[model samples]
Target: MGRSKDVLIYIDRRNCDFFQNISDKFQVIFGLNNFWLAKFFIKTKYILFVLVNIISFYNNNENGLVNAVVAIFFATVYLVKFCQKCEIMEKMYEKGYNLFNENLILCRLNRGLFFVLLVLFCGMGSALICLNGLTFFVCTHMLLAFCIVLIICAEYFYACTPRPKGKSKVKLLFQKIQKKIEKIISPEPVPDSC
Candidate 1:
């Protein structure tokens, strides 16, 4: 009984550490310094749109691909504008200005966009749940929804938690992978001959 309790505690601790590591990596990837957040949003939305269109096509719905392309284009434009506004706000904050008063309109617009995204995600999740009877739909759609929720939760945790000291494990792993790729891609020089 004692051994089982110890094993359970170890597992719980490991899970917490894993979550913290994920949260840290999420923060670094989506840090507010540049366009990472914008890129993330754009990519995620585009992928989701594509997935939805694929599902529609499988269901014999015409015009799904065209609609997906149109939606992605508009979403990309909106996300770019939103990212610009966020950058402006960050600049204002850095300059010691009151963000709320200085960027009232932009803030409102951001809030509106956020709510729209929230509603869209919720609707998609509901649609997936409704189609849960289908094996393929349940596997793909629900997995996508789970990933989206996990990302959101990670971001939220990152915002609430203080930055951990030392380099992130994810960053180190990426750096190692990058170095290996570079070594593979850059061929060694041949000896001088003739």
Candidate 2:
């Protein structure tokens, strides 16, 4: 029993580390705030799957334009929500706020979006597989399946992981950028006439 407990603890620590590392990388790459980065990593697979489904459906369907528009709308909503989340995270970070109590609310929003994306992808995949059968669509379907599994694994790792504290490399880089922007926007002090 003790050994098992130790193993679980070790696993949790490793998961947390993994989360932190990925979150940092994502922040650097996407300029997402830490809080949003956490959510993004958790939802990465679903987002990608939804995108692929949208593109595939748009390409293969008769009502291609309509499908493409709707898919684009959903993608746009996701991006907008992500931007809003990043703004909220930035405010919270500046306030030194901890989200421990609000984790459920944040998670529910994240999970709900993920669920919607999953259902959409599944429906699209099923339609393609059924209508098209074991044809060229099968290759795309297989790729989608692989991506879903990969996303599931990623979600697991993120769930097991804890949010990282302290400034990440990305945060530091952004700080520098912000400082430069501030310098540009703020007027330089006039040299003393005397």
Candidate 3:
């Protein structure tokens, strides 16, 4: 709710040289609580996903490669979740800069303990890899793929909430349990993350 003085701002790292020139060094007011860590974590997820896709595809790594095979689907799913219902707002600060075209998209989200869950899952993956005689640094792709699988599963559960007409029993279950799970994760009502 406050225009934070110190905050973590993130954008996906683009490999192309052109994006470096156009990247805005502006801090938009963050609409949530102290979310530097959360924002950084979300950025990390995208980095991991992209790295995994590159490494798996480039190295021809197909051993236990279901995650790689369906990566495009997962990427699409993640994009839909993040970019759904975004509204581009006309600029109020573009009076001087003619060379730089800039606009903001208002995208709302129910973060709903997503950052917390992601850390836990990623940690679990790290633990699994460590136990199997592998270093986390050595197997970033597998670890992230594992974490992303859990993220997609969580997304599925969220999607099943009884928001639509003619709700199924599963949706009803989600509706009833959603509040309880949120409460368990946080005492105060959690706000949007994205």
lDDT of each: 0.52, 0.57, 0.41
- Per-residue CA lDDT of model 1 for 45-140, tens digit only, reads 556655655675566457766765675577568656655655654555457665333333333333334434565666775777786566555455
Candidate 2 pairs with clashing backbones:
none
Poorest 10 consecutive residues by lDDT, candidate 2:
153-162
> Judged by lDDT, which candidate is best?
2
Q: Write the per-residue lDDT of candidate 2 for residues 2-61, one digit (tens) a residue.
A: 997577556645654566677666655655535555455435644665666676775678
Decreasing lDDT order of the candidates: 2, 1, 3
lDDT score, candidate 2, position 173: 85
Query: Candidate 1: where are CA atoms >4 Å away?
Result: 1-42, 54-61, 100-194
> What's each prediction's TM-score?
0.41, 0.45, 0.33
Q: Give the Å error, residue 82, model 1.
A: 1.9
lDDT of 2 at 105: 37
